[model samples]
Target chain A: MLLALDVMGGDNAPAETCRGALMACDRFPDLEVALVGTGSRVAPLIAEASSSVAKRLHVVNAEEVITMDELPSVAIRNKRKSSLRIAMEMVRSGEAQGCISAGNTGAIVAGGVLVVGRIPGIDRPGLGVPLPAIDRLRMLIDVGATVRSKPLNLVQFALMGGLYMRHVLNVADPKVALLANGEEEIKGDDVIAQARDVLRKGPFTFIGYVEGKDIPVGPADVVVCDGFTGNILLKVMEGLGEAVYALLREEMGQRILPKVGMVFMLPMLKELWTRFDYEQYGGTPLLGVRGAVIKAHGRSKAPAIASALGVARDFVLKRGVELISREITQGGM
Target chain B: MLLALDVMGGDNAPAETCRGALMACDRFPDLEVALVGTGSRVAPLIAEASSSVAKRLHVVNAEEVITMDELPSVAIRNKRKSSLRIAMEMVRSGEAQGCISAGNTGAIVAGGVLVVGRIPGIDRPGLGVPLPAIDRLRMLIDVGATVRSKPLNLVQFALMGGLYMRHVLNVADPKVALLANGEEEIKGDDVIAQARDVLRKGPFTFIGYVEGKDIPVGPADVVVCDGFTGNILLKVMEGLGEAVYALLREEMGQRILPKVGMVFMLPMLKELWTRFDYEQYGGTPLLGVRGAVIKAHGRSKAPAIASALGVARDFVLKRGVELISREITQGGM
Candidate 1:
């Protein structure tokens, strides 16, 4: 599978991106990678890798990089030679099976939708992020793309999320849930109520309405909602995680014995911390699209970028795009 | 100030409710308390209190109690003699300044709106809860009352939440923020964009759009949104708090030294725990109403009921209803 990487995308661009691509080459020997960025900027980092690994990496020169603050529509229109734009175009032209970018989310989302386009029957493509649970991770879709959605949109999200879990995470018949105010079928607004009705009658194993608290409990494999609510919930969890860690650190500093005990508990603490870390799980896939488009965080380091590349490669190998398109066309609400 | 309490409401009704009312009487000498519930259930608990304190409590007989499973609209219509309905009627009939209940939230909200009516010029009333932040408690409105709302409704929530923060929390020129997916003005859905436009030109110190992360950081005095997003955010925060506390308790039990350290840290831990405890905050006030109607948790204990009464008394004494009414009449939004 040929995967396009935006080498000049994230905060730690060129170096981390190049290093991550090299790492991916080592991990998956059969995978071909095209590093889409300025060749001069990425060559030094590529040189650090083994000669054989460097030989495996192909450089496609692109001059501009989209910044975090740039307007997404304008950036895509003006920066034709930008790495993020070019990478997405490669997938559109069939040069690459999938594309990965750790850059401006707006630009990435815009490029994925407007440039690469959505699947034939899909209403809107959604971004799915895996949330950490006690036993396993829960995939939350439409995290920040397509804010205003109809009941059919939510049903599509559930279908796509379930497919992603089945193919990628290897969870068959992933229990799908509609994020609502309560767990009752009669609860929630008109959108949720209608979605619940449609989902129950449509496809997949509908688990009825799941409350917001259930997201972390892992009762359901795929939780579906509009991008607005999903994005807000995702950020709230992230903020809460940061706040808890800060409070724990503060409490550990109040006494001498507790401080010593914290040192002893470092390994256990590290294990606990990894459960909430997003980088370990890699990039979020923009599902329900004609081709695979993965978005990594802007602050992602080498490990995160490498994980993103692996995710893109796996999506291509698993034929995620084709499966989702087929599912939507055959049984979509 | 006179406060009416539903003694037979909540999970620990009559017992904890009776004790909490007596505790409130002891704490504030000028406060008058009226316990409304079935005489058979509450008489014994009231008799358990000190004779002098018990003498100050007035017992009003209510025939029925609303169960958690009963629909709020149906409960209000059928259970006319219930504690929740009677207590709210007391406030409506001018027999009490404010009503407090730890009964069914849907019933409380339904009765509060139907019986007490909305404040003049207000569109829809909302449930407002104070979230415990790092530096201070931030007020979030429309927690779960009205699910479907327009941009105008959000503007009203901002006005009501701002007034509540200023009068109740004593914050001057309360900074108001629209809870959105992103901080950018151009970001979010159509409703959020319209809310931003309205808020930018309306009264109160608008702080622009605030992300979900800012809710717990206490960046704004008032965070406004439709009930759907607000309710989800509230429940997610509660779930995270419970999850963190549970993890901490388990960690404290892992070793002897850590257990010993936990003993010393118990007081501080308790203090931190209290900050996130919703029971301490008593009830969510139904803002944009003619008279104050407080809705406590359906699973509330007696202490929570008593605290709700205290909140009611404070709202009445401060003339919060009239102040907000006048503010709206004077074009607060």
Candidate 2:
């Protein structure tokens, strides 16, 4: 099956995109990637790939490029020939099963909604990222797919997230919960209060409100919230993770004992980091979109892009988007 | 100066409160702490202290106790002589300069607002917790004081937080930024977009919007957001910290070499943790209240309680309330 990759997206674009496409080919033999970008920059890199990898890779040259700082909607409206647009168009035209972009998330979400369209009964599509908990991976849904959302949107988040976790992550009877400041039924604002009522009776477990502490450790398999809360929580966790490792490194530099201890503990520390690393986990899927779409981080390297491609491939093969479509249509919002 | 302590609050109540009171007396010579709770439960703990330490201790009987799970507003209206009420009453009556509670945060906030009253010109009172960043502290305001806040309340949070950082945190000119999902100026929803405009026109240095990553490592000295966002960010960071350490310990158990490595690294790791430890920072101040009110964590031990008492004492001595009143009244909310 053919998948589209935004070759000119992310910080290290074109080169990394070419390398990642080759790596993704190594993982999934049935996968063929259509690299969407300027051919002059991408074709040379694709030429460097081994014949086996190169044969599966094809470039979809789109002259226009959307810079990272460019406004998403503006890019969508103006740069219709941009790589982001071309990649989504491939999905829209059924030329590719799904597409993965490491471009601006806002642009990708906008593109996914405006260009690729959303599922029949879905009001808003959401981005779901896997949060690595102690014993398991919990789905953190709507991580900036929609900034301002209604109660019904959150209910849809629970539906989509529950389906993804159950099918892809292979968790039986996944617990779906709304992310709130407090776990109490009466806590949170008017919107959340309204949401609690609907989510309680919705399709999925609907275990009720959960706090931030519950997100990382897992009292629930799928945690749903508005984009605002989800985005901040995601970044804060990322910042803390970076700070902890940076602090540990600084600590080892301070004294002799720690400096010596690091030599033996390096392997364990590496394992500890790998356990929490985001690159190993694939792209954040933009659920509710008409076709399968995955958004990798903006600063994602070759490995992460490749991982995202694999995620896109899995998303198509695993029928994640199709399940959401069926769930939304049959469930009847 | 006398500060009232809710001796029956938190996980390790009366005993830890008494010990913390004694510890505070040791730290600050002029400080006196009124242990407000059941005299029977608190008096013996005070008696356990050295006679010299006991000189500064006083007991005020509060027959009612508001358990952690007790509904905050219900507790406020029904349990009139509860420890939280008595202590806040002490602040209201001008008997105590301020009060510290390691009780239910919602109840403490309610008591602080309803009993102690809000300062003049204040729209809403917010909680300010020092997020221990890598090098210094970033004042994280509105840590669940008012979950559903207006844009204007966020404006007040910025003013109060900026002032607190400049005076207490000792930054000459503190940089205040609105906490958002993205660092871009137009990132957040309508409320935040409106808040950015107000903050830009306000008294302090308005450094546009900052993401969650900016909180744990500094770009802005104070980060302002609604209570919901702030609370989730705080708890998520805490959970991630705990998870990282727990994971490391588990990894160390997997091998003898790493186990030996852990022994040598213990002191350095301890020092590293101490640097980011919340117990060292003291209690979170409830800003915009008529009197100084601090809320210690519900699970606070003796050290955290002592730290909280010290914070209350500092709030009084440093005239933090007066400055906020002056700033708000003059600045015009």
Compute DockQ for each candidate against the true complex: 0.53, 0.76
Clashing pairs in 1: B16-B302, B17-B302
Q: For model 2, give the TM-score of chain B.
A: 0.97
> How far in Å is the alpha carbon of B298 misplaced in model 2?
1.5
Assess each prediction's global lDDT (C-alpha) against the native.
0.83, 0.86
RMSD (CA, Å), candidate 1 to true, equals: 1.9
Per-residue C-alpha lDDT of model 2 across residues A67-140, encoded as one tens digit per residue: 88888988987898999999999999999999999888999989998999988889989999987677788999
**Model 2 residue A328 CA deviation in Å:** 1.0
Task: Please give, for every candidate in the order listed, the TM-score of chain B alone compared with the true chain B.
Answer: 0.94, 0.97
List ranges where model 2 is wrong by over 4 Å. none
RMSD after CA superposition, every candidate: 1.9, 1.4
Give DockQ: model 1.
0.53
| Candidate 2, residue B292: lDDT | 78
True contacts kept of 2: 0.76
Query: Once model 2 is optimally superposed onto the true structure by TM-score, how far is the C-alpha of residue B138 displaced, in angstroms?
Result: 1.2
